[model samples]
Target: MKYKYILFDADDTLLDFGKAEWFALNKTLEDIKFNCNKYIAEKFSSICDKLWHEFKLDEPLNRYVQINYHDLYYKYSVERFKDLKELLDINISAQLLSEKYLNSFSECGFLVKGAENVCKQLSLQYKIFVVTNGLSHVQKSRIGNSKIKSYITDILISEDAGCAKPGKEFFDYSIKSLGTSNLSEMLIVGDSIITDIFGGNEYGIDTCLFNSKRKINKLKIQPKFEIRELNELLGILRI
Candidate 1:
């Protein structure tokens, strides 16, 4: 059956997030006069991932927090990276470092190969929405600066959507936002098996696993289709 709407995960699925992250991290390090090293990058990524994991555990995103989400996220990053703190002056706040990283990320508009081609092609026949989970400002800036935004009808970042993926509330919001309850008419495509595939399965929508790395899926959940590249999506849609 043909899918009427396509829900896409923005990061690795369509955008080159790894490259963006690396660029942003390097810029942040340089801006803050911290020595750039692999260890630092890994540590930053690890801390951010851990904080995001914790953040996702709480549903209805807003109800789970007391402080500003960005402040909390940067607070953890600064505290975890003691080296950076030692290097930074006493007056510099962790929030400033976080701001540097995000601004750098916003400046870099890296997209996966054939991302625009696929999205533009799919947008002609199917309503395409970016169902991403990340900072609203950063994600919006990246999309706004990139050509991919032209192919999307709307974007739903978890920060603004009030829920994170793999949670039923997220999908419910998307469905309700689009005024559709027919889950069968939509397809959820993303690189993450745990969030994208599992979320789609749990939400009763068809899942397309964009396994760019061709990694093994240890999860019990199975996607309806798997593609190695963005261009392959066209074939899946039989365009």
Candidate 2:
């Protein structure tokens, strides 16, 4: 009952991002006339996961697209195309592939069970916002397609804000946007310990780890609360 603002992570916390990502990536592979054999698709996904992990750590703004494509090419063994122009062409193709994935991903309106109900319930008592580390256009489209859009007060994407999660600047931007100076009255709910939990802790806000998959380890950075289901949040908030 102490928190008046609830900031949520968009991807896995509310959206069923893993399923959406799989569908989008498979669609992209098919569109590019690539053999999307199950094995190949899984391998490409692994490559993407690694690149995203690195991006999260390095926080390089300019190399976002380049790093993804570089990892894709290396993972798919496309480096044999030695001509610089050929490599560039391949990069363009990969970019298009990823763009399609993002586009399709935005259209997929898959939400985790209880996400809508919980958001709606919380909306009555708290100011709710989405804080996500994704491209502005894509994140906007996804929220627009979701049922919880009406319940959320604001959507903050890293691209438009010029900062990503786990950065103090990103949390500061979110706090500023909420029109509040008190950090104790805000709570951040997210799935990633490295980003959302850590970022919220750094910003001196309470945090809830949405560990739906029960995969998080006992980390040094402790979240104020943990819930395996979104519905549990209503009880935590005494809604």
Candidate 3:
């Protein structure tokens, strides 16, 4: 096989993080005696998604959650909660809300459609690792509780590596930790163009974009392979 190892992004790529976040955020808001609705969940996800993308690029973001640090550690997530509190006019502290949201989130784990079957099939011939940018405990609990957990060789999270994706430091740390120098033998598959595709491209490895959303108009860089579904990988790998 040309590729001996596969680095897959967890959220959206394999796990249904949208569903997890919706349930967790609603539960957290309800816990604080706030009316939880779809609008609130949508707004919250927008804020968080922007903050994280900005943080990854080391850009100053929303005033409430802006930080000089680039790591997507728990502290950064707490800052995000601050943004959430300010926007939603919540009475609770950011730290308190962060705790509530994370606790609720960790308990909610659901795979993207075909994720389990895809991972199981790929594991038969290649080393598959979940390369993700997320809070350590949250990623651990979510992934550990999922059915795909058995197929994954390991979950490589940004918090544990001290750097997130789209940066050379993160790729450097991940590659070294994986004990591999031949970049050609590995492939990166993910939903995020910036994080997974860009990072893998910069690292000189083949990248496959799981464009489940099919929004391809804004791609700054092109990946080596593209698939609309996990099952398509069977043809790519000649499995």
Candidate 4:
């Protein structure tokens, strides 16, 4: 393998984030006496997806951005309930809903299939770093509880990094933290075309898109490599 450092995305790439998000959101809504269904889940996910996409584009030092972003997502989620205006009125803060969701999400430990095995095996030959964009506390809790925690050399969250993915600042900070300036020796593997692929591509590093769902690449940018399975990365390293 040519790469000395491997930066792994922690969400859908390694952890089953969709499940965690769904569980946390529904659980939070349940606490507030709201009945949630698949329709609400889908709407919440869509709203969150947009927020995260925007987050990945800019650097915000205030951690309040994370809270406020989630609040906005929750507000949109509440909008789906037509008659719930009376129950989920102005008094209901997005911050409250976000805090509830984070609390519930932190307890989730759903890993993608073969994530631990792949990480364990890769750690032997290459330095593995988890690069993620989310609340530091929430990301830390989930990563700490995951089976692959021991295998990761470090966990870099956007909250602590002062920036998110697709932005060169985050990657630059990561490079400095790792004490390496050789971008050519680093490889980034992630699920997001906008974040993982675009970030690595912009930062001058090799990138591998982990399209577990086999989604087509509609974006103009393309990754150096693409894999449908986590373990398939091992084969990429062999050559």
Candidate 5:
């Protein structure tokens, strides 16, 4: 009720990340003459999630990406034809996969239910910002192409800020960029407890965990609030 700034998470919280990732990866695998089966896709998701969790635990970005891909390749025995470098050949494979993912991701632009409307309504009273752990170009592309872009006051991506979420530095950068000195006058809304909620809590900002899936197990780190729908924010904000 006292917040003047509202920060949001980009991936699953705002955008339908799972849908986009599935479409892109499936298409990319098919294009590369690989079987894009559900099992493979699920495996890839698990691998990516683990890598991200490691990143949250303070692994360097470069090492995180490299190790993740390397492990995936190893697990799939993808080096039968060539080495990891040859298999990943950025220009041919990595870049293509990234582009495909971004394209599919940008094309969908599906916001959680009431997200756009909430942004529009909240924009009248609060300055809205997006704090995400992602490449700047990719995050910017998604934001610029999304319906909520017009309502957002600013966006802070990890690549541009040289830090990722759950890190105090990234939250500091976001606070500075928002030109707000009172941490209590800010709220962070996101789906990830380890990233969004924990990061915001570290910065002394109120956090609302968007647990839409209702999958969060018993955890020690409790968010200030939890909601299953974006519209539920109205109740918390008293809008």
Candidate 6:
């Protein structure tokens, strides 16, 4: 199927979020007068990943509480730091640490190996939009400093959408912003099956799974297309 609009996920899709997260986590820990080791940082990653998955679930299996709409990103992100603080038995304020992490992460513009090439090449033929479950300022700052910033047509963040991936409200905002009623003419590509593939499939649009790490898609969901590399996308789209 031909696609005029290609919505890409920022973290783990184009941006090297893992490295950026490591850098940010270390910086945040340092701010608290603590040094971060691989184990400590990985623990933080695990905690945040679980919280992110919960954020995407329909009922948030583990969290049955009412959703907090105000400062959605801050609410969701600070919770991860709260969990991390408890695990580390730290006295530092979770809110302050989370803010520091965001500030540090915003300075990161590290791209995946072929990200610039893919975005640069695809921008010529397709309307490229970054669809992310992230803080607006952090994402914008990271992208703005990157070379592909010029290639990106725009960005849609959950903070702005007031909803996140795997949720219909977010997809509704995305579709309307894309200004295209034809689902067949659009595609959503990302490394996540839950957010990108499952969400796109549920929304009646084509989905492409970018499995760069070769992780197993344990979920029942499947994407319409899959590629192991960003450059491989050029071949799939016949660019």
Best by lDDT: 6
Candidate 6 structure quality by residue, lDDT tens digits, 1-239: 37999999999999998888888889888877898998998798788878866764333212222123325446768999999999999988888888899999998999998999999999999999999877788999999988899999999987678776766777888989988799999989899887789888988989999999999888888898999999999999999
Which residue segments of model 4 deviate by more than 4 Å? 30-36, 46-93
Local lDDT at 95 for model 4: 57
Clashing pairs in 6: none
Q: Count the backbone clashes (under 3 Å) in each candidate.
A: 0, 0, 0, 0, 0, 0
Ranking by TM-score: 3, 6, 1, 2, 4, 5
Give per-residue CA lDDT, model 4, range 34-122, as digits (tens). 88898877766666556445543233334344335434434544343322333345246665665677788987778999899899899
Find the candidate with the highest TM-score and give its number.
Answer: 3
lDDT tens string, model 1, 76-168?
A: 555544445554343466667767777898876689998989988998899998888777888888888888888888888766766567666
Query: Which stretches of candidate 2 lie above 4 Å from their native place?
Result: 32-37, 53-92
Greater TM-score among 3 and 4 belongs to 3
> What TM-score does prediction 4 earn?
0.80
Q: In order, what lDDT does every prediction score?
A: 0.78, 0.75, 0.82, 0.77, 0.72, 0.84
lDDT of 3 by residue, 96-172 (tens): 99889989999877999988888889999999998887777988899898998888888888767766676666688
Please, what is the TM-score per model?
A: 0.83, 0.81, 0.85, 0.80, 0.76, 0.84
Where is model 5 poorest over a 10-residue stretch in terms of lDDT? 76-85
Model 5 Cα shift for residue 174 (angstroms): 0.7
lDDT of 5 by residue, 103-146 (tens): 55555566777888999899999999988876566677788878
Model 2 lDDT tens row, 133-191: 77677778888888999999999876656666776667777888999999889999999
Using alpha carbons, what is the TM-score of model 2? 0.81
